[model samples]
Target: MEPLAFSFDQPLFQLASLPITAGHLVAAAALLMALVAIAAGRRARSLRIDERDGQISALLAAQTELQGRIATMAEVFGARQAELNQTLSQRIDGMTHRIGASISEQTKATHENLRRLQERLAVIDSAQNNIQALAKDMAGLQNILSNKQTRGAFGQSRMEAIVADGLPISAYTFQATLPNGARPDCIIRMPNGQPPLVIDAKFPLESWNSMRDAPDADRRQQAAQAFRRDMEVHVRDIASKYLLPGETQETAFLFVPSESIFAEIHEHFEALVQKAHRQRIVIVSPSLLLLSIQVIQAILKDARMREQAHLIQGEVIRLMEDLSRLDERVRKLQGHFAMAQKDVDEILISSNKLTRRGARIETLEMEATAPPGPSEKGERAVDNRMGQLKLRVVDED
Candidate 1:
């Protein structure tokens, strides 16, 4: 085969019936080359388009997976948020309950404390009022005791109260006149024919009070001497006036009416006490007077009881004799009742026998009246007459 030649300057087709030159052939060849290049470029463009489509498919698949993951994450987040909300709500409710209970307890305790405080305050106010009333009473008592006459009256009243409380009205007499035309403050009558006891209530308190209230030792000594002289004089007067041989007891009581005065006398005036004792005079304070009065009352009671003892014994003996006689009479009466019962029983027995005889007589008479043989009729009549005779005998008995 001949060598195949390639023509670079040849036209592949005629355009318009004109012979194309080499330059034209060259241009056509260039054009043809350009066309071939353009076709290749178009193929490359198709390849690039296919590659882009594949990348876009892969991206779409990735996007779909990412979307599914986001949806799952959102669901989980929603569930977790709901759980946290519920937990928080539960904790808040518990805290509210605890706080409410605590507040209620605290309020109750506070109210209790307030009530106790109010009660204490009321008690304190009552105590304050009592203290004030006591102070007023003390002031009144001080005023009453300031004057000599009122103080004497107060002491006398106290003595009277003690006497009235302890002794019966008939046992004591106030302001009794003695046989010597001297009047004693009080006289206590003794039972069992004993002599009466005299009590003098007037006392010399001025000197004693002066001695107690003296400003100096010298003044106190002077006041004490005066007190002793005044007490001795009073005691002598009481011993002379109240101690009547037949009318009053040998010992007379000089009532001081004040315990303080009595204590002072005993503490400072021993010689005066001895003098009064020699004169058969007893110096007594209010408490000592009360005790002496009680002793006298007891003695009086015992004496009265002793005086009545014989009469009581006589009465008891008579009562015992009467009880013995009553017992004997009751025994005699019981014996008489027994005898009467026996007689009544005997009479009832006789009455029963009479009734039986009368019933037999009635039966015999009825039989006699009935039709019978002559002998039988004679026997029945005889039995009826015999039964009548027995009933008459029983009636006599």
Candidate 2:
């Protein structure tokens, strides 16, 4: 059945005025009963809409309370914002100050470091100049060593320099004659002042230089043979010239070629070394020479030290004489000083005695000027103590 739309102001009930026959009256009654059921269903729907409206009003009141809470929270947030801003400003200023202070300190430290570095550089510059001058002098000295005429002086100066670095120069003497009547280059004294040990520095350098200048292997080999032969002859000659019995304590030293040449001789010629050793001639290279000079320098230094002891003993005797004279003079001065002190003491005694006499005279004068006391005014008619200053009845009174 289809239901009709209902309006609240208009009544859903309707009355039908009808004229009907006995058979149509029942059909009309059934139609009225169907309209009553539709009206009841519409009324129930309206009751449900009223219940929903009441619930909506309660929801609106809750929304109003929540808005008031939001407004209070906003005010509190505004005050907190102001406090946070103040604290943030102070922190920013402090941080800025700390950053600035750190920057300033770093800059100052850097400046001080730079200044110190610059000062050190200046010192280094001065030291560099001194080093340069020393190097130049050394180069000039080395240049002088290349000449044959100055070679002896070179060898002597170099050897002396080496010895003087650790050993004293007084240990050796210039040009000593061996027992064989041959003069060696230099000799150092023994501790007992015996004949010094012999060493010869003169060697054939031109021939070695000639061998160095050879171009081919054949020429070089020939030069090598010549150089070896010359060395053998040199060794024999040195032994014959310097090695003699009762001349020196040790075998004579034959100073040879440079270190390289000495190395070559040892590498190539063992036979020559044995022959030379048999002849009592030991070839010394530069390194070996250094050791020899040290030994020789020690021996001579000990001898000189012994002589210096005698010299010192003589000086001590002279000093004792001077000390005796000095003591006599000191005694005379002490006697004079004592006399002066005694005179000063006597003068002080005389001054003290004069002061005591002046005090006594002042007392006598004061008593004469003062008037007589009332107790004994006319009793002293004899005037016995006219010039005397009286105090009590003890003395001449």
Candidate 3:
């Protein structure tokens, strides 16, 4: 009655109440193969993901360790840098201080050297001024020495100065007139009523100058002969004028102003010196005259000492008498001091006893109640103790 239905899935058999077909079996087998392929792919993907995760963790750990090491190295380097900076600063400061000190020392040394140089320059300047003054004096002296009368005056003046310096005003007289109306340059009064010693400062130096100025040996010889004759004549004159037996010393001094001239005469003219000495005329240079003055002064001093010998002896006797009286008075004073010392010792003993009694009284306590009455024997013992306590002062004088 119905139209026949053509179908691709035809039921081959019925199992229980379900119809089974070939198309259904084929679809089930294809689905199972697809599920197996999908499961295997998922397992391989999970294994790859686990391996990548392990590698990432290892890299992160390594990076963290490297960062820690870098931080530690940075800290060490910073500390080293700080130490280096401090060392450099200290060295720089030390160098700066040393350099400053060196500069300061150098400045002080320079100033000291400059001061020394200035002092030396000042001394040189003073020396230059003194040299100028000395040159002027030399010129003046040459002018004075050129004239005969001025030269004689100069010699006399120099001799006067020497005598005045050596002898007292009362001991010597300048331009003293003798009994024979002969005037001498100086006269030194001798002690003990002896005749005064005479000094003559006049000397003839013209022939000496001529001899020194001679151009030839013959002229020099002639000038030297004249000089000798002049010297002999001057010596004779001095002897006749100054060597008066009753008025002046038997020996008279002929003063030569120039030491060089005196030396020259002594060296070249031995005969003249002997002649002068024989005639009681002693040729003396300034130094020799000074020595003679010293000798005369010593003689005068000895004579004065001899004259006062009696007075000195009398004074010594008086001093000895005074010293004996002083010794006797000192002995009496010592006896008096011994008595005073004994009195002082006794006073000290009384003071010590009073001090001990005062201490004993201070230690005793005051009581309001009266002490018990004493027996007759106890009263006698108390009286003896009180008598022992009484102070006795001794007088030594």
* Highest lDDT model number: 3
Residues 1-397, candidate 3: write the lDDT tens digits.
Answer: 9999755398767789988776666676777778877887787777777877787788788888888988998999999999999999999999999999999999999999999999999999999999999999889988998999998999999999999989889999999898888899999999999999999998887788899999999999999999999988888888888888888889998999989999999999998899999998899999999999899889989999999999999999999999999999999999999999999999999999889866654543232123556578767766665554442212211
Ranking by lDDT: 3, 1, 2
How far residue 372's Cα lies from its native spot in candidate 3, in Å, is 6.8
Per-residue lDDT of candidate 2, residues 59-125 (tens digit): 7777777777777887788778888888998999999999999999999999999999999999899
lDDT of all predictions: 0.83, 0.72, 0.87
Question: Higher lDDT: candidate 1 or 3?
Answer: 3
lDDT of 1 by residue, 1-397 (tens): 9999757466556668976666787887899999999999998888888888888888888888888888888889889989989999999999999998999998999999999999999999999999899999879866866777776666667767777788899988887899999988888888877888888777776677788889999999999889888888898889889898998999988878777778867887888988999999988887888898789889878878887999999999999999999999999999999999999999999999889878877876675464445797778777786687678667766
Candidate 1 residue 104 Cα shift, in angstroms, is 9.9
Model 1 residue pairs with clashes:
none
Model 3 pairs in collision:
none
Model 2 alpha-carbon drift over 4 Å, by segment? 1-82, 100-193, 200-241, 246-249, 254-295, 298-314, 363-386, 390-397
| Candidate 3 deviant stretches above 4 angstroms | 1-99, 215-218, 348-397
Q: How does each model score on TM-score?
A: 0.52, 0.46, 0.67
Total backbone clashes of candidate 3, pairs 3 or more residues apart or in separate chains: 0
Q: Please report, as a residue range, the 10-residue window in candidate 3 with the lowest summed lDDT.
A: 388-397
Residue 321 lDDT, candidate 2, scale 0-100: 100
